[model samples]
Target: MSTLAGEFKSAYSAGSGDALAAVFTPIGTQNKPYRLQSFYDFTNAASLQKDLSFALFHGKSLKVPRAEQTAWVDIFAAYWEAVGELLKYEQDWPGASLVAIFTAWKKVANALIRGYSSSAGIPAWTLPCLYTVGKYLRTFAINADIKAAPQGASSFGFQDDVAADIEKNAHLEEAARIINRMFTLCLSDRAPMEESRKWGIYQTTNLIFKTYFRINSVGLTKNLLRAINAQSADLPPLEAFPKSHIVTFEYYVGVIHFLDENYAEVREDAFFRVIGLTQLMQAEKHLATAWSMCHRGASKNRELILTYLIPCHLVTTHTLPSDQLLAPFPRLEKLFRPLSNCIRKGDLVGFDKAMSAGEEEFVKRRIYLPLERGRDIALRNLFRKVFIVGGFEEAKEGQTSLRRTRVPVVEFAAALRIGTHATGRTRIDMDEVECLLSNLIYKGLMKGYIARERGIVVLSKNNSAFPGTGV
Candidate 1:
């Protein structure tokens, strides 16, 4: 008890926010020095209060500064009180619900925020402690909502319940409101660059971004972007923040654009070197960077980056992931490798089968629509083969030999039959083949003009037959 009190006093007196944050941080978080579990006997609230009070107020060795005494005591008291409730909730004690625990923690977070805002000296550094508190408030609210649902309810059923009753997840909604307050507090800070609470902006935004996403309120993310953009001139550069913050912010922003179907923008922001690349090509670069940045740690983050990257790579570059790339993530390989092979071989029938096999997972990850677009690329590859087989026209003397650019529509119809694995008795339709070719042209996957009257596709000889690929 004395040692914990000494450490807390030492951290508080030195104005080391990081150390103080660790003191209040829960167990299981990385590198946190003093977990609440280490000091308080959570099973007994009376003993917990006595130890917390002795640590904060009554100990002979503990000496809180007079000017800061009130705020410090209030903050620590609320924090331990909340921790006591959290322990009860975790053990599923009678009458101890997530809602009650969340309500307790909110007071702790509010007390810290109040102290930070009211005390002008060195409390700015403790802003991360505020983030830790707000993060759990959101977490507990989510768990509370899950607990409120009927036993064995499907995720879709819970979603339907939420839609039918806005109050079903009221705790989560309330958590969001408090996190927004945290966001506003961080954004509105006018302190000097070095001492500013503005440094906490992205962390707070990331928390709210998570909350909004969990509650199926993705459109709200745009308002967050707008608010940040309005204050960008006054804020620090994104690169200046910790890599963890930068990586997470970029990830959410990337997903936002991806969900809006703005693949080009996602790629444009990835790297300046590949400016004119296809939309998904750029998007893959962006996602690849995110993957590389976090590849050394956090397997979950790496998996998420690759989950989106593999589909983008297929649709834009007309390529498949090598074994080396997919080797580290077996689930991703299982989800994508078959689709990759099917697209590469122009096996439309196999592609449909692969999609069906992984439909549940793809939809769950929200990558179904983007991945479904790979069919067009498969069609493009199939037609490229047809063009290759058509070969060059024979040249007359004094005339330069040129490759044949005009392909009969019958040729595409035949390729479609083979790609689809149609039986010999199955008849192919020329009109449907024309419709397919038109779609390829419109999407720039193929560079050609369809001459409906002549029943042929006139490829553009000026550039490669396919836009991105040389062939």
Candidate 2:
């Protein structure tokens, strides 16, 4: 006990925030010198009180400076109170509720934030301790919400009609409110650059962004962006922060625009060709950077990046993911490879089957609508094949031969029947095929003029008939 107190005092005096944070971090690591288990056995309340007292108030051994003693005492007191409640909750003692557990942890977070904000000489490095406490507060709140929900209810069914679903997620909403406080604190700091709380702004913003997404209040994310933009002149460049912070911030921003269906802008340059909105392209760049930077670890994060990237690529660029691209992620391969095949082959029936098979998973990931739009690309590919099969026109005696740019509606109708796998008894509707062709032309996917009376499509003879495709 004396040795632990001595170590804590030394770390506090030296402003070794990493060491201080590890003391409160719940999970144990092989290299962490002070695990919760090392300090007190949860089974013994007396032992916990004794150890906590020695660390916080044993004047001879702990020796906290007088100026910062109140903040120090309050921080440790809240942490020990939380630890006591956690013990009861873990043991399933009577009346020990998840809400109580979350509340206790929230107090610890509030104490840490207060200390970090009000203390005169607190190092900015201690900010991560606040983040760690805030993170667990969110976790416990989520768990509490799950525990509070009715048995057998689908928590994912969060719609305006279901008042119960909204009520059940109240804890998550509360967590978002507290996290926003942390964000405001970070953003409002006016300290010197090296010791300022502003360094923690993105980290807190990322947490609130995640919470907002979980509660299905994605529109609130825009408020966060606007807040950040308002203070852009004061904040450091995004690149100055850790890669984890920048990557998460970019990812949420990307998904926000993605959900808004704002992928209309496209840009081409010597080094790269981006066929999506400016925000999405920027997101892809950062996600790609995250993938390359953390190649050896963060496998789940890399997979998440691909989860949105694949659909973004398909919708904006009319391109399919390559086999090599999905090779490392077998689950993604199963989910997307069939769609890629169907789109490339213009097999509409097969595409529909693949979509049905993965509909639930796609919808759960929020990529279903964007991917559903790939049907148009599949239709475009089918008609492109009709032009290919039409071949070249016959040459006149004194003239050169030209590629067949005018295709009969009947021929396109035949290809559509094959793509849709129509039965022999099924009638192929030329009008419907013409309607599809007209949409492609209107969307600029194809450069063509439709002749309704002549029942033919006169595609542009210019080299770029299909705008995105290298046809």
User: All candidates' lDDT scores?
Assistant: 0.74, 0.74
Which runs in model 2 stand beyond 4 Å of their true positions?
Answer: 1-7, 10-14, 28-65, 119-121, 153-167, 262-296, 396-400, 422-425
Best by the TM-score measure: 2
Q: What is the lDDT of residue 251 in candidate 1?
A: 71
* Poorest lDDT segment (10 consecutive residues) of candidate 2: 156-165
Candidate 2 root-mean-square deviation in Å: 5.2
Candidate 2 residue lDDT tens string, 354-465 = 9999998787777787788788888888888888878888988998877788888899898877776543425677778888898888667899898888988898774567
Clashes of each: 1, 0
Per-residue C-alpha lDDT of model 1 across residues 1-471, encoded as one tens digit per residue = 454566677777788877777666645355433355655453255565445555567755545555456677677678767777777776788989877877888888788777767752335777778788888887777777777777764443312212212336678888888999889889999989898999999999988887787676778989999999999999999989888887777777766655555333344243521332444555566676677677466876777777777776665666678889888888888989898888888888888899999998776666787788888887888898898888887888998777789999999998888777643426788888898998888777898899999988999884488887777
How well does each candidate superpose onto the true structure, as a TM-score?
0.85, 0.86
RMSD per model, one decimal: 5.3, 5.2
